[model samples]
Target: MAAVVHRLAGPALLAHRDGIRAVYAAAFAEPPWHAEPAEADGYLTRLAGDVQRPGFAGAVALDGERVLGFATAWTSSTPLPGTRSYPRVTAALGAERAAAWLCGGTEVDELAVSPAAHGRGLGRTLLEAVTRDAPDARCWLLTSVRADATVRFYERLGWRQVTHPAPDGYGTAVFLGPGHPARAAAVLPSL
Candidate 1:
């Protein structure tokens, strides 16, 4: 069956909470993520709080009540954040570019598609559903360079890599959405 993608407001994601957790547990259990089961628990906790953040928005793909994928995003702020991968992202882009290009833009925090749904384009559909309302198409996301296929997937979707992923391919790469104002200038793939 074809899946339907829905743009959800904050807190509303909780309606599909269990389904979301199931997809997260399955999608991120391999490759660079290798998320521990406990991480899924932590994600649930974080989602509860994330729903309250300003400009918070999300999307969920349902194949008849079963969540096939999901995406979450919210507006970023100046000075950057000190949590999770934000510091590394900020350093890679530098303070000037970070604030000008990313701050106030939609920051995609999470996007997951179940392995079972991999070839059906649900990933791209979920991403666009979540980012469609980004102010000026100024949306961005970061993923580990270790996830080579992931990097390529975003590139194929017209996202531009803004920061060099790293020499050993160990660092995260920040990507500017296709319509971002600064997309043209971020052409170089080297640091």
Candidate 2:
């Protein structure tokens, strides 16, 4: 079955919370964000909050009744929120440093697609939904350096690597904006 991509608007945002949680859980299972399953609900709630925010938005691709993929973002005067990690995620891009990127731009809070739903253009669709509306958005996002495929994917979509080494002892990519010129430089693969 083909996945139907839609904007979760109005109160429908909250209705799809569980499905978003399921998608996130499956996507973040790899390094630097091996989150405990219990935290899934909290993450979804935060995403819900972003959906309701005036300038924030999100999109999801549903394969039948299940959420196959999703992307969530917000325009803020602040940088991305810092993640609480055991032993501290990394010294390079700590919470405070990570938050700094939020200045003067919109942040890609989270973008993930379930393994089963890979190869479709859903991720780009979700990104476009957030960016198309905010033409002034200074595109920026933070992702683990070790997540090679994710890094390559974002690079292909025009996000850049602004951070030196990832905060979690891994490197991270800090995108400048969608379709930014810096993205043309050779992508720095994870060491």
User: Which candidate number would show the highest TM-score if scored against the true structure?
Assistant: 1
| Count of clashing residue pairs in every prediction | 0, 7
Q: What is each predicted model's overall lDDT from 0 to 1?
A: 0.87, 0.67
In model 1, residue pairs whose N, Cα or C atoms come closer than 3 Å (at least 3 residues apart or on different chains), thus clashing, are none
What TM-score, computed on C-alpha atoms, does each candidate reach?
0.94, 0.75
Question: In the order shown, what is each candidate's alpha-carbon RMSD?
Answer: 1.9, 4.5
Candidate of highest lDDT: 1
Candidate 2, residues 41-94, lDDT tens digits: the string is 788767656677656767778878889887777665553334543123324445
